[model samples]
Target: MVNLGDLNNDIPFDVLSRLPTKYMPKLKCVSKGWNRLISDPTFMKVQSQKREQLSGFFFQQKYQWCYDDITTISYIPVEKQDAELHKTVFNFLPEHVVVLASCNGLLCCRSCFPFHDSCLYICNPLSNEWLRLKWDEPNKENSFALAFDPCQDPIATPTNFKLIRVKQFETDKEALCFSFEIYSSDKGAWRKSEEICKCNNNLYKNRGIFTEGVLHWLTDGDEVLTFNVENELSWLVSVPIPANEFRSIPESCIGDSDGRLHYILVSEYGLQVWFLEDYFESRWSLKLCKTLEEMEEEHSQFLYNLRERVTQRLAVDMEPWIDPLAFKDGPLFCFTIATFHAHFSILEENLCSKFLTSCTQTSSLLHGKAIHAKFIKGSIPHSLYLQNHILNMYVKCGDLINGHKLFDEMPERNVVSWSAMVSGFTQHRFYNEALSLFVYMLRDGTSRPNEFTFVSVLQACSLHESLALAYQVYAVVLRLGFGSNVFLVNAFLTALMRHGEKEEAFEVFEKCLNKDIVTWNVMLSGYLESSCLELPKFWVQMNNEGVKPDCFTFASVLTGLASLGELNMGLQAHGQIVKSGHGGEICVGNSLVDMYIKSQRLFDGLKEKEEMAVQKKQAEVRPVGTLVQF
Candidate 1:
């Protein structure tokens, strides 16, 4: 057994080149000869030739400014066993850096500022080395892109790259045209490309897919704008959309997977993926067609089992009853609706409806509404199930008027129907209506209010000065023996604090037997609202109890320190933020900026003002939870 590090130049080049890319950087630091061998241009070419599969994908997480934070560059390996590679973070680049493109192992980043002369940087994340390319062009705003192909080039250099920026505006002829400035790494200067292509400037930006030695930008009109980096030519390739439900190109997403161009059509029935089989002939082949139902499991057996369990608990006699004509003015229909409601209680557990509801709630609101209309035109039993989910989707989408209307017209109601209406109202800020509906549901006594119902009701109570109402709900929770439940207790504590009942909130917090991260965060946030001095003690106690803090915890703690002007404490917390890998988080970044600025004002007197300015710029990009004041 021989140590690889101890091996001399007598070793074969094939064996030396077979070592992992990650090891190369560390091995470079081993010895002068080893470093030279690893760093040689010929050795790098050999390594590239031997590499079969892609190592991983390089992606950046947007915070505020485009800075090269260690947390920014992420390497996601295709193999799960190489999960350790995902933890490697590269942060050598300057702040306010936006990743334009990545080819081979090289990444190109530029300043994200609106319209200022900015430099573009090309870097190898594996080596953590960068080369800054000066782009001192005019200050007018331009959309930029990076294109490179190491495999296609006969001769490859580390500096082989093409930076293309398009300045698009209407010409004197009143037709849209593009002016391009191309920068070749080989040429080392910017030059205007003679090829002028007509495109919608307003709709075009740099979301180009690099494949087949070409950078492809799918235009708004389904035309692929192609630019060959090697040949330095620009042309258009028309991508003919299949005449189907998705009438426009916007309904489809263009992607490059494994060096092949792919078009993904998000149709109503399912997702259709087409690969460009022949680019010149404009030939495409259907690669995969996966329907939503096939992708999701049918929850019929689980739903039936859940229904039976609920029916056994609620029914006077523990026996099954089935009737097709149950909904037509009969007690059987009433029983059926009760059973249906039980299944709906665990609606989040139902895979099919949950998937469909998520789709509707997030992006496809119009698509969901159309599907609901189609479901309404179908048979009865299936329609009941569909109606329940549709009701949830409408409520989730902020269509409370329609949600309430649907609830009112239902002949029979269950806990799910009632809870959906109450939750929707609470989410949409219709607090009064949500509270009123909860009371009505309790009075109806048809179904017992679950944890979700109580949580939603408590949330509504917290928003208003309804301290008495919240106490009433708390009493009900105690009567139902759910007062010890951590979730409900947290909601109860939050509600108490919201109504300026800090003393009562503390009482609730002290009684929480199982205090999770949210429990600690909620109590800390409440204390911060009043500038309570007990935050430090609570933070120490949280640590002693072995509770690891998250982004929210740090944000609240940093905010408290910022307000109290505790510079030393804030710095300590900032270190913790970095250690926890939440330094780039939007909320945490805000508090850091505020804390630093305040600390500087007290001692250094704006010495770190430029750094603060960069942070503030980053804060502007990441706007969520940035309410910390100077």
Candidate 2:
């Protein structure tokens, strides 16, 4: 290799800009002259342009091993003749990591395991830099899309980005409308956009395709929901043809090519690509409509090799398989027989019901009803096990009418069936119905209440602040020898406290056998709710018990400190929260802000009154519907 330093200044900018970005760190170590050349502002701009022009695609492959599933990302370049796929595996990421959207070179991901709508991270795998963002918006029925403009500066380092989340709020009359919350990196906070758009609740799987300065969603109908990232406005554009005129839109998908919007349709003929030739005119030009026969003829050799490889993998069960999706990258998209088999099995004998139950997570009542009709008409047998699952599906899909109807129709009911109905009722805020069902189940005496049953009933009690009923439930728990059960006791304490029975709540908390972190959090939340000034003592006891403080613990303590206007205690707690790596949490940050504005040293009583007014205004600006409910 030629000496980089000797030719550094003389080297053509084109050649230097064409080099991969990963090589920059290594080249910077060659010599000072080379380092200066690579780091130059002009050279950086050229490099950023080259990087943007480079064609590549990113996708994830999931493999299930026993009970655990691992997802690996692959990046494939289109221009290179023989490019090796770049793989990224983040071990620290949650088991159920979902790629929400990609903007520039940064991937926006959310961790869905252990907790849904838990945390989001914006990461650049090339730079190995990532930041966890506190998502303070209500994530219910929400769709998140990431948009970044790199017109001036294309390098995917820390820069200004706007993350848009659209959430659907359904009215009692079944009318669907949406509200938006936009998170600006500049603001370092999420703001509720005043724009609310009316639309059908037919979003395609929490995914949106970003193109040209807007994010687009292909609904079940002919309408394309478009949200302008810059202006924070949303509008619907009609498709050239009605969705029903062609194949089912549910099976179709929307994507982006270059900077224009594209709709992909997979039909019996083959893959047809439609490009939007004019955004305002809503004119679409047919790009490619390759027949399956032509595709098969072209990919015959590759298909043969793929078949051989899949056969070998199935024979040994040790050989790894890869399913490449190079849709927008180039014409290298490939799928293996193993993938087909995994998908085809979804309609098989035993798996179809399970798939229906899993689809409940989508909260699509219409889809659930369709599947229910299929189950009734299909080859699947109608067993009690399947009935319980159907009941659960209806409940989870928010179809309580059908859920109750099916529950009452069950000729032979078990504990699972009753628990499913009760839990569903409790989840939908049907507290009276849930409690009445629990009582009915007990009076029947055939199916006994399980842990889930007790938890659901306790939630209902807590909702209505039913202290007398809570005591009665506690008596039943004691008689059933479940008084020592940590889960039941925790729920009981929550119910008691919500009913203003603070003394009884503490008595129950102290009588608990094994106090876990959740137990402590419940007690802390109870104390904070009651305005009890014994949090300091409780912290001492918690430390004595060797239980480390978690985010919830710190949030509760901070709430207490803020309430009392104890700036010293608040400062100490804030220090611990930052040290514990929860400083970025929205709740914690809000508490700190309240504590600061209320600090006795910072403001006199009159000043405090003024600050409180300002704080209240800020708080009013942040509506409850904007943040994750949990």
For each candidate, how many residue pairs have backbone atoms clashing (under 3 Å)? 7, 5
- Against the true structure, candidate 2 has what lDDT? 0.67
Per-residue alpha-carbon lDDT of candidate 2 for residues 1-630, written as tens digits (9 for 90 to 100): 888755656664556678866577777788887677777777776675452444555645454435343454555555553455544434444444656777666678766432434678876655556777876642534678888755434333336688888788887778898788888888888888998788975886466777778889878767788888878788887765564654322235677766778876544445567888877778898888876466546655332233332323322111111223223222223222222223321233344454454345434344446445655776356678878878998998788998899888888999999999999999999999999999899899899998889988988898877878988987888998888889998899888777667787788888888877888898888888887588777876887787878878887887787777666767777778768877656566666666666664444335434654665566563312110000
- lDDT string for model 1 (557-587, tens) is 8878877777787778777777887866767
**What C-alpha lDDT, on a 0 to 100 scale, does residue 549 get in candidate 2?**
85
Query: Candidate 1: where is the Cα deviation over 4 Å?
Result: 1-355, 379-383, 600-630
lDDT of each: 0.64, 0.67
What TM-score does candidate 2 get on C-alpha atoms?
A: 0.47
| Top-lDDT candidate index | 2
Task: Score every model by TM-score.
Answer: 0.45, 0.47
